[model samples]
Target: MHTPADSAVAIQGLHKKFKESHALCGVDLQVRQGEVLGLLGPNGAGKTTLVKILTTLLKPDSGHVLVNGWNVTADPEKIRSTIGMAGQYSTVDGLLTGFENLYLIAKLRGVGRRTARRNAEDLLARFRLSGVAGRPAGTYSGGMRRRLDLAAALVGSPPLVVLDEPTTGLDPESRLDTWDAVGELVAGGTTILLTTQYLEEADRLADRITVIDAGRVVADGTSDELKAAAGNRLVVCVAEDHQLDAAARAAARATGVTPMVDRRARRVEAAASDGPAALGRALTALEDEGVQVLEIGLSRSTLDDVFLGLTGRARHRAA
Candidate 1:
């Protein structure tokens, strides 16, 4: 029997549906205590539905979900009590000051008035929102709002935090700040279930990743494991625009596969098992053929590459 002392989250044969469309099909997942698990999928891939079920906002059609070792179906309140949620959009109250928002949540969670004030102040400082704690959340910048939303979720100090695309619309600086915050949360022994569109984010934060497509799990593994499954490749960029075809020929010859060319980027890419060695040979071949190369690099397959290789579709659009 599963217990709160073991896994943070455990699911088996989970299924959910909307009208005739099935959202989850026998989905099973496990999140180790104090580990960050990245849940990845394209839009409309049942990610939202599954998160809802875990948060006790929606009921699954069938199967079992245990959160913090409490069955989601049988002891929803117990599960809910241990979970903190930060959704895709900011849930901060626009009219309320940052400190007020967190203070309110603390009080609502049954904290004493003095303790609530202390917690709110501490969270504001921790999230780098102390400077803006007196400002109305509506008047805050995008990054500030996101930080406030995240801080608010931790008011009760829940053991499991569910972050749904927490950095979706933030600037690079803000995203990094959020990443640091997540790291701190984990360092403090909090487990996180993160769903995100940014492969880089998952690659950085997750100890393990679970990928779903069309409402079904397509892959699950560590970032390196997933990348290895996608395979390694060489990327070569020619100096002169006219040298593109020559570079492509070199890449193909070195890798024993037809190289893909991007004319706009003046680049040629091809899969290579030997990575650096293949890239070295490809460069030598290009040099011998008098193809002036501007730049070249060998890269292992990335999470984006893994998603493309598995789902045959781009996960994130240019935004």
Candidate 2:
């Protein structure tokens, strides 16, 4: 929940369009101060559009957007000064060294030369790019360049940071580093609005998640809440190849739902409200029916399952 004073960014009935395509449809969002709110969806879901509106880069066709208590349309400059933005693509100057890149951003933000240099060095050190601070961004690895770009965005130390798919192309290790950096920023009281296609990233970092689809917010809540709303857990067990179908039928009869068979592993899988208890009952049913169960276990639904259940499309499904 967001109170007026606790909100760092707020949107009410936001709408936008490009010819026949509606980019946003009466979208509403609220970001509380010092919280990381993840905006998640497939491509063209309007995550970037919402970030642009909040950052004052693009105007909404209708509705109101406020950042740090200032209306974006009427107070763009004030809002800009209080927020930092890093887009999906790295924006660092390729010819400039890491330190130079940060220094340039600090200068552009109106910091004096002495202060800019200090800020640049401090950020480079904090992001663990100090050793490569002298190397041109073009010469750095993908991970290092990303770190430098993130450092540049933080040179102003704004209260809110907007990260749009900030780890899109990085390796797993680099992504973890970026996650650590974001965690540090939020721990120090900076609010973050992260737009990402990665469900695991959102599950790991976001205090709340907003899932947008076709330019509208279809779902919004903490991860657990969303999972609960999506409903049902599935328990699976492997049986002998000859008894697989029989076991599945027995489980289905016990759970009152059709069991799915995994031909490759000779497994029986079924969905139920209570996974553990359901698994126990399923095992008992199989045993009573003279069916042998090789292995069985209960597991909670994943964010992927929730996404598929809500959107009728897997998170990784093509747009």
Top lDDT: which candidate number? 1
On TM-score, the candidate that comes out on top is: 2
Could you tell me the lDDT of residue 6 within candidate 1?
A: 75
Q: Tens-digit lDDT track for model 2 on 249-313?
A: 77787678787788788877666776567777877888877877777775566788777766678
Residue 268 C-alpha lDDT in model 2: 70
Model 1 misplaced regions, further than 4 Å? 1-4, 236-243, 246-258, 273-298
Q: In candidate 1, what are the lDDT values of residues 158-235, reduced to their tens digit?
A: 989999888887888888988988888878888999998778888999999999888899999999999997778899
- The lowest-lDDT stretch of 10 consecutive residues in candidate 1 is 310-319
Structural similarity to truth (TM-score) of each candidate: 0.87, 0.91
Alpha-carbon lDDT, every model:
0.88, 0.84
